[model samples]
Target: MRFSRSRRAFLRAGVAGGAFLSLPASIYRTALGADVPPSEKVRLGFIGLGGQGTGNMNAFLKHSHATVAAVCDVDSSHLAKAAGVVEKATKKAPQAEKDFRKLLDTKDVDAVVVSTPDHWHALTTVAACAAGKDVYCEKPLTLVIGEGQAMVAAARKHGRIVQTGSQQRSDARFRQACELARNGALGKVHTVKVGLPGPNFKAPGVPDSTPPAELDYEFWLGPAPARPYNEKRVHYLFRFFWDYSGGQQTNFGAHHLDIAQWGLGMDESGPVSIEATAQFNKEKWFETPEVAKITYTYANGVKILCSLGKGGYPGGTTFEGDKGSIFVDRSKITATPPEILKSTGGDVKLYVSNNHHGNWLDCIKTRKLPICDVAIGHRSATVCHLGNIAVRTGRKIAWDPAKEQIVGDAEAAKMTTKEYRAPWKLA
Candidate 1:
């Protein structure tokens, strides 16, 4: 069914069996500016309270039109801490819950910012859409290629605005570079160079230990396999493990590769084939490649070479064409011969979002797709996941981007989606 109310209006209307938010309308009239329209204020739910979660939460809280309606985290302490932050800011306590499912079931939440690990992204987003909630989810959008597709389908099926948190997509410099490349300022782009963070074993690693009292390790694991508790495996360090994340190949690759896909005009499609090489630890300290060099070949013959570790092309994505090239990251964007960077004032259709969180909040009002929409994020994330698949299989796998499948090698195709543990169902 089509929606007239954006996610915010349905949230207020108690859509999907959710009750109306407890806060009075007068609460926001004073909490927000008098000049601001009442229809625009959105109460967002915060899920996951790790580093990225808290960072995104604070960023969204800065928006004058946005308020936190609820906060959820697997760890009790982190959940309480995030709730405290919200209460301190609004002088009102947002509902808190350990199970994210409970948070989604609430009508109080207009939209959800999902800052969970890669594995949780698809499930949470898909569930949120089914619940009629808009989503701002972190990248890489999913733990595997199929999950990205699933996310895109759910958002479209439910008419939900799902913005992937590839915030670099909203950066001015990145947009300029993509606009230039897209507008043909780069002149028939042939190759793109992508660089990702090299691997580093966190602090020599720690041994498996008892689960912390404040943490629900089982819930945190969720769909990921059950394993003994290890401090290194719990928080920031979880990226190195394949069960939760795809290492630098996906962590940083998700951002840079996304730029490569956007610049190459390949966000709706992906490479035809992938060939890669990687280094690994003998002791299996990590499941992902320690060092990897991946080559993704497009059906149109354009090539993107991504590297990590020593001799890897400098960090950031660089687009090279016959005329010139442009390289961009959060820090800076530089073009070859320097003068190519000065071109300006083009009528290119780059989604002009100066603020990432603001863009998501705006989309919740407009019923329009955000800068990095669900489909775009899925395609870009597929590019990163393809690199991992090629490394793991040690084979040159052919891909059919249109169908979102492995053309050959049934063995390789299995990596595209993961099997969730009991009590955590993607369906």
Candidate 2:
């Protein structure tokens, strides 16, 4: 799918460093402000429409302030199905295209929801920002570390609002739990246990098959190295492959790790050292580990342990402190000593988002940062990416948070950003 000429022109103009082409402030005021609330209608475009994309679209549909103006997907079937869902819900048919760049061309769209796979996140998001559109991209924020930094730069340069879809940050229960830990209500927090779901396990072997016609095979590969499409390498199962994603580490780690960072008051920063050990099935079809343990040591002397386990913990953050330990997940929160739960503190400020999509909508109107801003999301995602690097290299890594790079390891540094496929630079 190619970009339309008009879209390319619009993006080209907005890409002049930090100088965004100004639409009149009154245009924004009349369209976004106003007592009747300027239609309360924010035209939205969706980039990926798989299982996750469909769910995210539905979430946005619930917002009276958002309308699905356009949709795009690499798979035609997924595109058609998602468009139907949006039409049924909104009673308004959105323009559907296989090429995502075309959706970016639509002047009616003020924001884009990128539900694409990990490799595509940075590319789609940077393009959206260059097009002068706000973006809500799924986590982990980047497939690689440098991409995360590039994403932050692009968003800032274009004066665009970008939200990472680490929804747990917007949850009241999760926010309250993080605040409790941060405010010392849980006492001197020493360690945090971040649990994520196990890796994808399949039979020992499956032969790669011909690409599905409904899918744009090359386009889907995007910036990742070229590989033939296999059933195991597409759809939800793609999470198991390193090329497309970092398996459950990034898939689920993005959520749990972000919460762990927030609880430790390290959202804007990250650990300086990391070491990891992972167990992989040498004979299995999966490329990622089935079980692993990673330890991260922050400059402030806090340690975070992230692991994969079954049945015991429900994959959330456990903050252990001198006073007591608090365990919080999606369903509920529990803490030891019980008193910690009842003790309310002044700094336990809740993010107060009834829903994740609504928070982005509100921020778009207010021009404030969303609960999971780009920088915070990038830092949390860096932890997950670094853990994978440690495991893969079998070496302890020294990281410079301010520079956002691995220290003293040229080999490790090379992994920070991948070379894009021809004619598809990260910029």
Candidate 3:
């Protein structure tokens, strides 16, 4: 999509530093300067103030141009705490709400940052888009395959700019690593090993207890099937439950699998076939697999191996090619290929910011898609979800990316989209 003249001028001027002096102010005020006032604050609202959400909120607060205007959480305690934090950080008393819908209703909020759990992502995102608010949603994009497709459609349909929180795409080191692999620094790339931390597993114990009064347990369940609230089943541990999330396959896998696809130049598409085997404890409290190995074979014969294991490649990805291989995680990037370390005067597309939140803010004013657009995020997330589906169904599944469905297995295809609870349907 073509950016409006104001947005184009803002991007050109911001990046090039006064390069577009002749650009019209009308274009700037109408398009690029809509949310960001001349005083330089980008009014922001945050939803889901849990661990990850709080961290994301702080990251956005760190930007000089951003100001927290409102905060929302299902838990009243979290909502209050987040509002306090925002007030302390920005020195502006932000409004707080237990229901995220209220945050969306605020006209003072220019953009919405959704760091809600997996099940809540699609619903919140679709609502935000319908409200005419730009969105910065946390990664794995959607809980199910169809949700991602719906999100992409909603963003386009509403003309809202959306950024998926796959932060590695904005990291220079990761981008450099991907560019190196893409440009054949890793010659004849054969296999990519993407490793994620194992899933959550507790002993067979702990009867369901009463949920804390401060939290709206029913609202927290949202579109997920009704279930008793266990402390472990609600917040961060929601990743372990099949009904809420796809375990680490969607959690950490979202990050590593994305990089693997970037290196393979398969950001817009996915593997043609997926097959997986996993080890799970039926007797244990955990519903998701604790350890598993899933292999995805692409049309070009490139194989991506995702596994739950210890040591060497924790929370990172390893690219193996005919030339050599490289291991990259959040903290470091290393390569066995000596030439990769050596200077190469090759051109590469580098995102301007290393900070993920900053990149989103920049893109909002520029009206350009961020590094992790909905399409790219959805396709990469599909790799993770497909692996989980293959393991669960214990069969090789054929995928048609265009149609976004399993070829013949009706039962398996049914899992692609979930039934949202009453009023929380995806738009």
Candidate 4:
């Protein structure tokens, strides 16, 4: 579980302002417009080979200009599956490793794609950046508010390109919806309605059992409190447990709420106050909320009502303005007073990224910012985490997005940062 010498040194340097930030530029190709030759195509190492990880790996494999140089996972089964898919596509076997730290030590890996569960996101991302590798990490960006900020700080300090996998940001309809709202075509957006799915915990009464031999349970639980292995506690089911995820709140909310933040032009800021009410599953099966309704009001008086499974409307983000309203989800977009749809969204165009994965690759080569940059992703995730904090504490929390702190509630503010379990720290 040892990190590379460079990664160890970087970790020892800590998050102090000037340590990693001052590293000589000789190690990185910081220039823009440099073409990566065929032989020098971006070298990528992938960690966390689950469903989303495999999907992202497939997308990267489709990129002719990139190489899937390595793969890592705590689950032997998942690692074998990913290796099979990668080998079939590239006609070359990817170097495999069980510990992500070992993968970081590989000199050939120029960038890493982190698709680990929420708890592992910040540490993997920070370690990768410190080791001189760029990162494309999956969303909810971090499990807690403090982790999000640490992730932003890490990427900034190392001058690395970290793209959070909120792929909806790269979709066409979502982009156009945000553009319309931003350009005043929406005529002063006053409200944003977001919807999330309900909790679906299938293992409510299941008993804990020994973990499968194919899985490294200890490593998977890194940074999370120790718990007995249960079939329902790993993989997709991990979303239901607060130790690893924020349930549907951070699950689907990360997507829809992110769009709400984007359309409202609040990517750099957040709501002033939050009001929420949540219900837990009767079975006490999961730690996250069962059903919740959270409302966030920005400083400008814009109010957002997020309904989980109770919006009465479909599951998606809707931007409501004085003049018109636009409802858009992953599948489609609709505009009321439909003629407003024809209006030119104005000259202020957001980044055009038809493909999120391709967008990351292009930015990696050019050293340009991708559409959903780390800071932007962190801001979006902050909104989600704050909503959860409000739900869990059952209090209307006031926030200072600039300071990234809860305004008055001492107990609630502490939830912003969690105590890591042990040796797994948020470096």
Candidate 5:
């Protein structure tokens, strides 16, 4: 079944910035009743208060050590909605700002949660790190490979805690699955299968139009190329476009593939080579592939076959070894031999993190790296990016995990980093 989308019409459909604050992390705190101490609290500022951002805010609200200090969003509506959530929970209104830089500059903010679109993730994270604030950035940690590198650099240089929001690392099922694969419970693992969901772009195409009053369209397009505002192109739907995100390849791939990297014990490194093929929507409804088969080869000869779409492998990560296989997703974990699932997981015990947000908060106090550190997120995202590069260029890409480069392919290498749209550069 070949899915084809017309490129000519879509190609004709469209045309189309901030500073760092240098300061020490804030120790400022407000009254948290008699139970919590002022010195033990982590004042959090939030940037990009959309669906994911709001979700993250609610999670942080559950912790007594975390206090919502401020919220920022390009959309005024989002800012208001987020503020309402914070106010209802804390019984106090958080400082709201249209610009993220102002949120970072606030003396009350010791850390920030960056749930912006993929293009804005790197910039927000690097800037927050430079401002002496810790960061919890959403998955697919960067827009490009180079951006991830820059984020890692800034985090290390500032001595800030930067956690990548690959929350699966905290899930018990995923932890057991990775432990089995790493501890030889799965015998010498040779193949790992990762499945991602198809794109969710169901809306019909709409013509480009004027920006809404509530949205700062220009500011929202920070670091991205110029383009007219289209209702379907902003907010949650931006994942379908190449200029903003790499579709489901990077969206869901970031989560599942990160688990694959963990199971393979390659958090600091990535596959040695990648090859992919994909099909796009026949109506040209969106730019990303509707279905794809990406093959990644690791240095140790472990093969990862990642399939996307309807007829692909079932949604989850499967590790196939000589003795048995372990399959895991958000729902449950299963092993081929049944008894493999009951194994004590040998001597290798992966990091135990029951709550993703809690781990970051604990690390913030201890000054230790969280479960999904910036570097791990970068390596996992590199795998997703390499798969996209292969699919986009229609060629096999040789990668160097140590040097973090695409070997022998100049064209593909260029896709690793994108040109910023004036003023907004990676920190």
Candidate 6:
């Protein structure tokens, strides 16, 4: 796969921190305003048409105020299926392209749904913001902490609404649970327990082989290190590898840990120290930990114990306070005393959004921050990334949350950012 000349130049300008950030104001419309009629639908471009991408497209299609206008993916099969779904639903064929840059170049696309792999999220999102379109990027927001910082910078500088796909933030059960913790319904929460599923890597080591005919292997690697393609190294299996993702630590952690951060009201800041212990696969089939336990100590003396594949703790987040404890997951919200669930949260209201997709659309029109805004996503992801750092290093990590640095550890600090492969840079 090759980049178009204009798209290449667009990226170069973005890398240089020049024209991409300072484009004319006229080119920056989000396609909806007072001048635009109320009945006008917001046009969305779908990128990385994997399972999640296709599902998001269907969610948006259900709303009469939104329409799928474009679809992009490195895989021809995925792209074709996405376009077909749009055509079948709206009776209008969407502009299908193999490159996301071309889809961003389309004049009619008001926003983009980025459901690509973790490594590609930062680049596509920053570029989309530079190109004057809003973004709904999938969670585990960035591959690294520095990448998350770059994304936050791009969104702020471009005045764009960048929503992270941490949909649990919009779920009522999670909301009620967080409200209980935040509103003193739990009576000074001191300990939070978060349980994450273990990595489910089943494939054995296999020889590297030629890329699939329908897939753009090099492009899929993107900013990730160059390596021979393996059957287990792409698609769903990518989560188990360190090169592309941080396994279930970032996968389910992005959702569950995000809830922990929200319930603890640590959206803007994070823990001051972290310590972790992990055990990897005995057979060497996967890279990330098979089972791990991490402890994060916040400045206010709140301690979050995160266990991956640890048998004792239940799945999801549990806020343990002096009075009672509240446990919440996708299924239900349960409290210890039983009466705590009856309280109306005592006016310590949190951001209320029952629908994640619809919240992004609503924020696009009002220019308000979405429930899972990019900054919040970044902070939550930073917590997950820090846990991985602690696990990989096998040591306690002293962190300066205000400064966002790994205090006194130069070698570990370098893990916060990574060098991109040639021709791909984040400014």
Per-residue CA lDDT of model 2 for 1-427, tens digit only, reads 1224553344333221222333324325543333335345678999999999999998888766778899999999999998898889878889999888898988888999999889899999999999989899988888998888888778766877788999987787888788788888878999999888887556655788899889998899888888877887887888888888898889889999989988877765689999999888687688888888889999989899898745334588999999898999999999898778887766545455667787777667666667777767888889999999998898999998766779999998888888888768888
- Full ranking by lDDT: 5, 6, 4, 1, 2, 3
Cα misplacement distance, residue 113 of candidate 1 (Å): 0.5
Cα displacement (Å) at residue 261, model 2: 0.6
RMSD of each: 6.2, 6.4, 5.0, 6.0, 9.4, 7.1
Model 1: CA > 4 A from native: 1-34, 37-40, 344-347
- TM-score, per-candidate, Cα-based: 0.90, 0.91, 0.89, 0.91, 0.92, 0.91
Distance from true location, Cα of 361 in model 4, Å: 0.4
lDDT of 2 at 335: 88
Worst 10 residues of 4 by lDDT: 11-20
By TM-score, who's the top model here?
Answer: 5
Name the regions of candidate 5 deviating beyond 4 angstroms: 1-35
Residue pairs in candidate 1 whose N, alpha carbon or C atoms collide under 3 angstroms: none
lDDT of each: 0.83, 0.81, 0.79, 0.85, 0.86, 0.86
Q: 1-427 in candidate 5: lDDT tens per residue?
A: 0102332122112100111222333453332344667575888999998899999999999888889999999999999999998999889999999999999888789899999999999889988988989999999898789998888778867877888999999999999999889999989999999999999996678889999999999999988999999988899999999889999989999999999999998876789999999999888878999999999998899999999998998898999999999999999899999999888847767777899998888677665567887877888898999999999999999998877888999999999999999998775
Could you give candidate 4's per-residue lDDT for residues 149-195 as a string of tens digits? 78877887788888889999889999889889989887989999998
Per-residue lDDT value at 132 in model 3:
75
Off by over 4 Å in 2: 1-27, 30-38, 202-204, 310-314, 348-350
TM-score of 3: 0.89
